[model samples]
Target chain A: MKIRVLVSLKPGVLDPQGRAVHHALEGLGFKGVDDVRIGRTVELDVADETSDEALTEMCEKLLANTVIENYKIEKLG
Target chain B: MAFRSAVITFPGSNCDRDMAVALEQVSGTAPLRVWHGDAELPEGLDFIALPGGFSYGDYLRSGAMAANSPIMREVIRAADRGVPVLGVCNGFQVLTEARLLPGALMRNASQHFICRTVGLKVENAQSLFTQGYDAGQKIQIPVAHHDGNYFADEETLDRLEGDGRVAFRYTENCNGSRRDIAGVLNKSGNVLGMMPHPERAVDAAHGGTDGIALFEGAMKALASA
Candidate 1:
């Protein structure tokens, strides 16, 4: 089984890299861009018996820092 | 008994020698240099330090990889047993990732790597790390990092403040740290994680000796214990 994990800073947390990219877009004459937020994705291949609970535990333990980030796991066929 | 200290060096750690030097200068005994792969730390350690650097090449996230290394299991156990642990800069990131400290270090607000000496206010002088300085005293310490912006929820910040766990505050708000927090102590006050490099400030030849008090403070605390 294969899965993808998306990790992003929480809504209220400041994303400096996202903000900098937004500024660069504006400087390049791109308009109508309200905001930008950056996040990362990690893809993993696990045993077919990998349970959802175990995946969640992986995110909570190391994939995402619960203090400032949130993660979502998606199953990919 | 003499001060038994250890400095754990991750593969990319650059300040381990400096941390060991500072410890030896204050404790009059060289700290054992332990590698990150070592699963067991030497027995009978009174102090442990995690120095700053691009640990694990700052991949994935700052300090994220090193925090889960083999040696950290032992460090966590030592910290839980009330052994004094100091984490500076990248080391601070590792502590947070290891959950030994609260909050996470994000990119600088300006999105630039800041490297310079900054003023810090000793917020809580009750910890073994800060007891050498006067309460509310302002001192100069050097900070150099790209991800030192500390963040924690408002409630956590309030609780840390209410419990007097905040150890140091940046006088100039060098980073976009929540509440201007530069350093924080664990709930038990046995672990300290700070963004500024006190080791860099320990020698007058390094431009200032303001950082000496922290090492001296640890020595004094261990001596009296």
Candidate 2:
């Protein structure tokens, strides 16, 4: 099974990179852009018997830092 | 008695030698060098230091990979047993990633890597690490990092303050850290994680000796205990 994990900074956490990107967009004359928040995607190929709990554990243990980021696990089939 | 300390070095760690030298200079004994792949620590260690550097190439996140290294498991256990552990700069990030300390170090508010000497106010002088300085004393330490802006929830910040666990606060708010925190201690006060490089400021020829007191204080406290 293939899994995709989306890790993003939690709301209310200041993301400097995202803000820089937002500023660059404005500088390039792009209008109507309210904000930009950056995140990471991690893809994993695992055995077919991998359980949802295991995936969650991986995110909790290492894939994502739960202190300032949240993660979503999606099955890639 | 000689000070028995160890400095853990991850593959990308660059300040391990400096940390060891600082330990040796203050304690008159060289610290053992431990590697990231090591699963156990030497027995009867008086102190443990995690030095500044781009550990694991700052992969995934600063200090994230090293926090999960084999050696950190033992470091965590030693901390639980009340052994003093000091993490400086990248080491501070690792401490938070390891859950040995609270909060996360985010990118600087300026979005630039800051490398300079900054003023720090000794917030809690009672800690084993900061007992050398007087409360509210201003000291100079070097800070070099891209992600040193400290972040913790308001409630946690309040608790840390209420408990006197905040060890140091930046005088100038250079990184936009919440509450201007530059260093913090764990609940037990045995572990300290700080973004400033105290080891770097220990030598007179290095432009300052303000950091020597920190090591001296720890050694004094541990020796008398």
Strongest candidate by DockQ = 1
In model 1 chain A, where is the ten-residue run with the lowest total lDDT? A61-70
lDDT by residue for model 1 over B79-191, one digit each (tens)? 99999999999999999999999999999999999999999999998888999999999999999999999999999999999999999999999889999999999999999
Q: Cα RMSD to native, each candidate?
A: 0.7, 0.6
* Model 2: lDDT of residue B162: 100
**Pairs of colliding residues, candidate 2:** none
Model 1 misplaced stretches (Cα beyond 4 Å) = none
Which residue pairs show backbone clashes in model 1?
A: none
| lDDT score at residue A11, model 2, on the 0-100 scale | 98
**TM-scores, each model vs. reference:** 0.99, 0.99
Worst 10 residues of 2 chain B by lDDT: B198-207
The positional error of residue B195 in candidate 1, measured at the CA in angstroms, is 0.5
TM-score of chain B of each: 0.99, 0.99
Per-prediction DockQ, in order? Answer: 0.89, 0.85
